[model samples]
Target: MKTIAAVMAASAFLAACGSDEADDETTTPDATDETSEETSDDSTDESTGDTIDYPDLSGETIDVASDWSGAEQANFEAVLDYFEEQTGASVTYQSLGNNVATALGTQIEGGGAPDIALVPQPGLVDQLVDSGDIVPVTENVVAQVDANYAETWRDLSTYDGELYGVWFKAANKSTMWYNVGVYDDAGAEIPETWDDFMSTLQLVSDSGVPGLVVGADVGWPLTDWFENVYLRTAGADMYDQLAAHEIPWTDESVVEALEILGDLWGDETLVLPGGAQRSFPDSVTAAFTDPPEAGTVFEGDFVAGNIADQTDAVVGEDANFYPFPSINGSEPAVMGAGNVAIAFNDDEATMALMEYLASPDAANIWIELGGFTSPNQNADTSLYPDEVSLAIAEQLTSAETFRFDMSDLTPSAFGGTEGAGMWSILIDFYQNTDDVEGTAQALEDAAVAAYGE
Candidate 1:
């Protein structure tokens, strides 16, 4: 959680640039620690014999566990510190470093899992929910988030008809970022359609500036393209179909999306020299810094925070944002990385902490700390660190539709295979731009092999 400020900044500087389905029957088996007896549906209160024991903060101590570190950790501590002051509950904060899932399981078995824990990845949420490692949050907490955050977030947080966790910050992935100065100098118009966008890329490439620089090695940035294409061509339902294993990867839409991406990669103007080899974190540097820099790239809302330390480029004016253009003037679609808090024990202290974290005020605290776009629908936009972030907050506020990461919606095995397939398709496409049909077939074949026909 070092924030990888510089690393993310460099990647964010790239448009600048800019799930799921499935039935319980067809779902991947839950992979969390088998030791966990608690399921997401479990509602037993350990402190009350058999009843849910609400925490009476008079002299109780609650421990919280997470992977948050550096600024992220500090911000969370601040939130908890404030919570302690208000509730008179003494709290201990523990940072478990990187091995969170394993540690949480061990600690939980030992009766330790901290009172409240932050589960960052969605796949983990699914596993945790199934294993009873975490329980559904209370109705009040759900209500608080519903009132403040966007519906897309609520939908993502809710699984199998119950609210298992409440998200504090959600990363919006359907975004493109560009250098204001570069655009101003070239008089290039921001692209609004997929064709227009490609044309603009050609124009920028023709201008002899780095047209687009993406760190393909990161895998996630490359994912941004597939997500957008899936939305543009197949729409959400189809996208969901792919995620749920309902549609084979060789479907027409999947093939077309790969071809389009291949075209983008084939363009010499799109990538910086050696960009194909760069990691996603470092690609941003190639795009923004002097000499061999790019004019545009694609990324997510968190890109701003990642870039906050580099190049004095302010958020609103120096940096600006636009949604991933309509694939064909269709509704704007978005992919999100949502973070959640799960409740395992139904004890009072745990419930109170859960309630506090999901509260509108807590959501606002997260926005002010500057790493997320709160999922709480009512979070105050004014609290965002900068204009660009505030603008994103507004977009989240008005967003009519949103989807979680496609790879995250399925089992890790499926997501990993799909991600690897995407990279393979992109690398092949980049090398064979002229062979669109061949490349498309190859991509389709690869996807089918990965997920089966």
Candidate 2:
């Protein structure tokens, strides 16, 4: 198997940026406007003059569970529909909302778990594996994953040296979305370093609008901001150590990253009126809406979807994104998040769905529909709806270094739980930016408890 870095390097050469003409002709699709019936008819194999003899699953039913809702839920159901079309299977999708981890755990314990689920956290994968309910993927699914995905994705989905899931969706979290009109009006160029980023924000603040708006109410967004800074400041070695609890959170490197965040978050004038209380979707829209409330919002590439759906702003024109600025003169790093498809049952219907998801053919269905990206190297990039989405896809495949979200990697008691663990600690830090040492110490204490270190 190739190293993840090498895999990404090799895949980068295969990707080309889409044309401006294609971008100009594209608009974000309304989730309600498209239906599963519309999507299942299009097949990648048929387009290339090839045919697949799918298993005859006429009477089989497969149930899938995930935390997605609204537009995301609709988009994924379209992919499921394509599987239903290929094989004569009836696939049912259930949205478990924000508490999917807990809910899925209960279902598995009581022997009522869905056939398969799209899990968002690797830590949860470990927990599920330990419960002895998760079935190792079939050999056919393994071959598809080996052929289509990067080693990093495969590694993340494996537990105890056995592959248990397939990564179906990916996120590039190292992005800062800005209002184009506000940036041009403030005469600010895209910042390349931490100092320059702050200067740009200051300039925007001087131009009568707040410099940034953060949706810190849920706290995971703050974790992303910290992870990007930490990856650049401390480097990947220490990042891996900290994530595994091999290093304390009170380490100086952690403190430095928090202090960098404090430079923007600590200030009252630099943030929108609600400060840390704003919702993530509202913050994304506020940055691009008319008479914008803030100059920029920082989050994952998925922010573009919210801007398109909630507000009427044009994605590549009225709203755009730049890479998160380098911190402490470190090399560029990409922080990402993804959903892994794990099976709870090894039934024939479950195996078929898993294999299809691992194939590029299944990925292209969602990619063409808009607001989706994939780690599958063979996934067609040209199917991306616009230049913004295309650029994000390129970033995911081409980065010199990439790491999954830190919070998602740690134990739920420390990272994944709501109103507790990393979420609550970061929220408290956002409200009290002066408590830098306290925040670091609090995180370290939580890690000790969660990791039993």
TM-scores for all candidates? 0.71, 0.88
Candidate 2 lDDT tens digits, 380-450? 66678788998887776667677777887787778877777888899999998899999999999999999
Whole-model lDDT values for every prediction: 0.61, 0.78
Deviation (Å) of 269 in candidate 1: 2.2
The C-alpha RMSD in Å for every predicted model, in order, reads: 12.0, 4.8
lDDT of 1 by residue, 322-418 (tens): 8888876677666665557877777777778877676544554556666567654444445567767766755644455556666655444334332
User: Candidate 2: lDDT of 83?
Assistant: 77
Deviation in Å, model 1, residue 416 alpha carbon: 5.6
User: What's the C-alpha lDDT at position 403 in model 1?
Assistant: 60
Q: Where in model 1 is the C-alpha error above 4 Å?
A: 1-123, 138-155, 159-162, 275-277, 290-292, 347-349, 369-371, 399-401, 416-453
